[model samples]
Target chain A: MMLEILTYPDPRLKEPSTTVETFDEELRNFLSNLEETMRAGPGGVGIAAPQVGRFQRIAIVDVSSHKKVTKHHGRLVLINPEITDWDGFEIAREGCMSVPDYTGNVIRATHIKLTAQNENAEIKYFEMEGYEARAVQHELDHLDGLLFLDRLVSRRHDLFQRKTHQKKK
Target chain B: MKNWFMLALVGQDRVGIVAQITDALYRGGCNLGEASMLRLGTSFTMMMMVNTQLDENTLISVIQPTAEKLGLHLHLDQIEGELHPHPEPDVKIVVHGADRAGIVAQVTGELANAGLNILDLETGVGGSDKKPFYFMQIEGNATQGMEALQLALEKLKETLQGNIDINLSPLETFDL
Candidate 1:
């Protein structure tokens, strides 16, 4: 099924949407739509409910194919996921589907162990690092209406335009 | 909300660097954002993005003194409006090697010589007793009438003398 895509500055992009208490068909279907929408977004690595015009506590993350996965590849469907543990301070460039056309560096935990329910309603936990951790954190921030711009290190440098030349040897 | 700038302070490592600089930012009505403070041998390096609600045009003037007071070489830049379009739009290059002296200088110098504007760069240096590696991603926009980024690639390779690797590609945005 087709999913709705929310563009930048949409209020629905803010305000952590309500939680998905029931692991019902509707919730599963919404999750599917989120995945589809994420795949369709340019440079999209993850997407939360708020980004897809949904207010449910759900997000689909597939950092598997990203440059810095550093782990196995697969999609993660977080249903009411809570960050149970986080450690270390890292400054990484982050962007969002909700706030398109902008990227900024934000300080986040280098490592994160999160807990959430899978499609089967079974609680699952995962430990992620590097880009995976950063991607998950970015998606989770949407659950609270927080954009990477809001957490940007400073306003001086918005994510600069993508460089056209490769680095010199 | 206050617009912020990232201040990178690099100098001989010493005590109270963070405190003193932060105090100045606070007094100047600037808000501190994410920062990484560390000691690289004898030198201490701090990179922080700071924000302030002060008028856009007046931000640099106010922060100039704070930067001087802290003895920091400051770089204040803005991310707004349309960027100047590059006259030449189809050139790219990549750099990777072991971390050592003159890496940034040597690479940036090539871009300068070619009259190419660097659009983006990501450099990572990592090593230990067991392994050593350096990675750099550079995207460049060439000047008009200069489609031969390959020429610059050869020059860069010769300049590095086999210590590094260079790859050339067409202009494209990874958006990562």
Candidate 2:
């Protein structure tokens, strides 16, 4: 089942998701749907429960198929994810499905060590860097009711409109 | 019916400029749309889109008193068409080198020749006054795509010699 992705200006997207305290079969089912929704989107590398209007802290990330990403965790299902530590910083441009018309330059940690729970409620620790780390950070932000617009490094210099290009004759 | 106007205000840096201007607009029942306000050196500048029922002359009259009190140079133009037009910037370009002449002209000229539309550009001088460093960041879009745009910038970098550094990268975006 593919979930409906909430776009910008939807009040639900701004509301923080509650922690997932109970890991059950239903939770597993929703995670599967979240993955489906992610795969359905155009070039979507990740998805979060909150994006589907589910007020639960759940997110999925998979950058294995991305051409530029040489290394990744394949697919990551993070529940109640927390970044235990992060190091370094880099500014890169990003776009979100929620905010489809614009992209912005954002500064994010280059590397991170995080702890999260799997579908079976087993705690897992992981280290991520480069594009994967950036992807995880972007998904985690959705759990907190934050968007890439909120993380823009410079409001004046960083924000840009995503315009469609017309092929020249 | 609401009329739209582009408003520009510049004045020496001081407190209450924004407050006074905004207060006047509020009293005049004018609503602000998109606005950018910043301090450059010892002066403050503001550009804003204003929506109001007042005509051009009346709107000018409303803001003139506040502008005069604040010692601001004011310009207001009645504008037509969409207030928000989408700007497409497909690539991000950063250039830095020792301060010299023709950097902006040469870079922009190359970009224009490559059929790239510059959406946003900002340049600044840093380092010591004795050894000033110039840097510019440009966001642009090209009809030919990122690969061709990168090639053009590379050629321009070579032409500028070793004194200037140019970095061009596509705007990387991931949907989530």
Candidate 3:
């Protein structure tokens, strides 16, 4: 079953999610629903568990379909995701499902070494760079109850209209 | 029983202006709503929507002294409880080109004339001083529909001699 994506000001979204301690059938089913919800969105590149009203440290990112993404590892379901180390920084416009109708320019690390658990509770680690890295970072922000607006470089200058600034597909 | 008031704080940029004023409000039990603070050129500007049971006279008296001590110009205007005119901008317009005067006036004037409401507008000038660049973005509501508004803005953009990107559809956001 596809899950409902929570919108902004829905106080539940702000609640810092609990870490996933067990990898059971329920978690698998929820992850599947997350994948479905992400794909259902037109040009959706990623999604998080808290967005669906589940306060858990789980997010999924897939940038392979984003024309500019040259290298990607397909669907990435990051459970209890943690960014061990990051390098470099770049400012880019970002939009979130929870905050409809607004997008902001946010500064994020260009490269990241993220550690997360898989469906079988196996710990996995990967080094991601460029668009894939950016997508992963955006999804991770949800777990911390922070939106692109909160991380804007300058609310006055960096916040932009996501629909028009679609220079990237 | 809550009363609403709009407050403006404008003066030389300082470190404690917000802290000083917010402390005053906290002492008087005023809840801050929407607020925008900015620093432009030499002056720092702040505007806030405050709600409290305190009367205008009493609230002003409490804040006025602290504001004066902070060397900030303060103005307070009571907003009627029922006369709220909040307009949410559904369209986003971005303009970029040569820097000069009247860009804002012309663009906003036309929008107003078209019955569109400007929700938020932010503009800046950058590039070499010899050849400055102007950039503007406005979140607005175009009651005339998307196509109509797009055509109207297109004409204005052409006339204004700049690149204007009009995003009529509300942007979609995703979480997680």
Pairs of residues at least 3 apart in sequence or in different chains that clash in candidate 3: A48-B176, A96-B173, A96-B174, A97-B173, A97-B174, A97-B175
Tell me the lDDT of candidate 2.
0.86
Where does the lowest 10-residue lDDT sum fall in candidate 2 chain B? B80-89
TM-score, one value per model: 0.53, 0.84, 0.63
How does residue B63 of candidate 1 score in lDDT? Answer: 55
Query: Which digits, one per residue and each the tens of the lDDT, describe model 2 over residues B78-172?
Result: 88735556565677888999999999999888877777788787788888989999989888787677777777888897898788998887765
lDDT of 3 by residue, B1-176 (tens): 25889999899988888888999999988888778988988888999988888888998988999889978988999875433444445667777777878878877776776767776788888889898888887776777766666667777877865554433444212222
User: Who wins the DockQ comparison?
Assistant: 2
Give the poorly placed runs of model 2, Cα more than 4 Å off. A7-11, A155-169, B81-85
Tens-digit lDDT track for model 1 on A1-169? 6577776777767787787778888777777777887888776678888777677778778877765456843789888889999998766555566655556558788789999888878999899876777778888888888777788774233433357887889
- The best candidate by lDDT is 2
Once superposed on the true structure, which residue ranges of model 1 sit more than 4 Å away at CA?
A155-169, B1-107, B113-116, B119-176
Q: Report chain A TM-scores, every model.
A: 0.85, 0.89, 0.88
- Give each candidate's interface RMSD in Å: 5.7, 2.5, 6.5
Local accuracy of candidate 2 as per-residue lDDT tens digits, A52-117: 999899999998989888878898999999999999988887888787767777888999999999
Model 1 residue A153 distance off true place after TM-score fit, in angstroms = 1.2
